[model samples]
Target chain A: MKELWELFSVFFRIGAFTFGGGYAMLPIIQREVVEKRGWASDEEVIDYYAIGQSTPGIIAVNTATFIGYKKKGLIGAIFATLGMISPSLVIITIIASSFMHFKDNQTVQHAFAGIRVAVVALVVNAVVRMWKKSVKDLVGIILFILAFLVIAFTRISPIIIIFVSAATGILLSYRGAVKE
Target chain B: MIYLYLYFEYFKIGLFAIGGGLATIPFLQELIQKYGWVTSQELVDMIAISESTPGPIGVNMATYVGFQTAGIGGAVIATLGLVTPSVIVIVIIAHYFMRFAEEPLVKAGFYGLRPAVTGLIAAAGFEVARVSLFNLQEYLDTRKILDIFDLKAIVLFGILMFVTNKYKKHPIIYLIAAGVVGVIFKFG
Candidate 1:
């Protein structure tokens, strides 16, 4: 119905414009779904973001699905995901056709160089924001630091780390040391 | 035949990638080493291009590899392959996530995820930095060793970081500025 089209277009615009992926997409989701549409409250959006991150998928797609379903159910989820991915699919198709031919073009190369630096800035901003909100207590801070170091210095796969941390959370909850 | 395998492989990646696009790098590296579809150098180049482009890095990389492997159709297959799992999972989760949202165990599980996700994000940051900024080959060659660091880039990074951090400016401003700098440097 009309609602489905709205969901599609809204997510289409978001997917088309969002450049840096999950972290960059976060604020857009917040503004559009939470503030403009009243689809979810601030806390709910945060919760969805956390869940979206932990779940097995692209964060933005997962988030859009969650929000879309929240608003309109199964059909909404389908439309939202389509909207989220369609732009990439189309754009990548075009790029795939042309990029190989222009692989070493100076303007393209220089543009990429600038974009990479900007990506660093984007990721840093995301980390700083999440750090303020996520690292609430000593244990959380410890986990953050330890996990960051383990990831940075070691070659341990992140999937293993996530599993271990989840287990730790369960055990801590069992011991009544932390309130989940 | 190969397209089906590629699809399934990326499906696995899409199914298990918990954090984001960058979290897919190590997984893709494993694929490259095992299958020979891509080389390490190509992976590095893909990362650079993917990050710079206007889409998800994983999708972009998948498309690039697919295009290289089997042309345009291959690119479509790979992109779809990488994205399909997430679409399926999200559809299922949407029906049930709220019912489970309140359970203490679920909360604890996600709480645990926060730190781990942070770790993944941090690792991704380090890897990109290492690839983009620290080119040891330039040092080994000794010619224009100083250019290895790309001083203009570093200064731009520093200024952008300070301005954004201090002023809490919108990210678009920085993106526009970077684009302008790229044009100036390229045409100058």
Candidate 2:
């Protein structure tokens, strides 16, 4: 019971504070779960992230579920998942109720205009950081460019892109192994 | 009936919205077209609020849409439906594939997926930039080249980029600064 409460509180704090979503939540997750709680090792957290991204659902929630299950079990997963989403539930509800009242306010409009542009910069920063970490070799570069162009230009689904890239990776690695 | 519909629709979104939070945008767009639950303009506003909020954009969006369509109960139900797949899948992976990462094929999959995810994120960034920095629809209507560029927004973006790279502060700081500037200059 105590452990479940702890899990909820830790993830609740993480969910409440982190601003930019999956990638931005990493540092806080590392701090609370890895360093402070010793729930999982650094490498394990990275693995969880990789798996979380590859799996269906939001990466942040998926990661919380993985770590929670690792610590306790099904019950732990429930508690952690609840904790992670609770903040969004509360905050968004408040905003939704209030936003209608101020939706057309001139000051609010100006603030959102600024906020939107700032968000663009933030997303661009995330891209640069992700690029350095993920795009390592020639094959990676090609995949990155191809995925970007397809997603930007066409109506093709990203799910298809992810599956095709995974297949390509397997085939490429298999051929390289044969050559060696 | 509405509750069931919310649960079913969001369940599908959770099942398929791989990559991350921003990936759900396309799905939400489809929902708008199909259900007319919210207008396209409202969707844009929701995205703005989601980006600036505390939690994952996907969860925030689910809450927003649910609240719009129904009420607080709807919000809770929608959120639960969206996360149900994730909870089930993660638990299954934990129970069945304890050593999943050690598998060579899984490693290979990640090797390919990393770059692909990067590209997806880049595309998302581009889409956000398109809406925030340019008035494409306005330009198309006016047929004016200068009307295409939001010059003030571009300037603000450049300045924020410089500050972010140099200072490395928490993102909220930049967001607040931008909001202040926007209020003063009446950006919109």
Which model scores highest in TM-score? 1
Candidate 2: stretches off by over 4 Å: A1-54, A67-76, A177-180, B1-13, B16-58, B68-70, B94-98
TM-score of structure candidate 2: 0.76
> What digit string (tens of lDDT, one per residue) describes model 2 on residues B25-126?
999999999999999999999998898677988999999999999999999988999999999999998786576765777777767877877787677677
What TM-score, computed on C-alpha atoms, does each candidate reach?
Answer: 0.76, 0.76
lDDT of 2: 0.83
In the order shown, the chain A TM-scores of the predictions are 0.75, 0.66
What C-alpha lDDT values do all the predictions have?
Answer: 0.71, 0.83
lDDT by residue (B88-142, candidate 1, tens digit) is: 8876776677888778997877676676566555656665565555566766688
Pairs clashing in candidate 1?
Answer: none
lDDT of 1 at A113: 63
lDDT of 1 at B126: 61
Q: Name the 10 consecutive residues with the lowest summed lDDT in model 1 chain B.
A: B125-134
For candidate 1, write residues A1-180 as lDDT tens digits.
899998998887777656656655554555567667998875566556566766787777777788888888888887887787777777766765776755667776676566556656656766666666666677777777777888789867555677777787778888887753
Q: Which number leads on DockQ?
A: 2
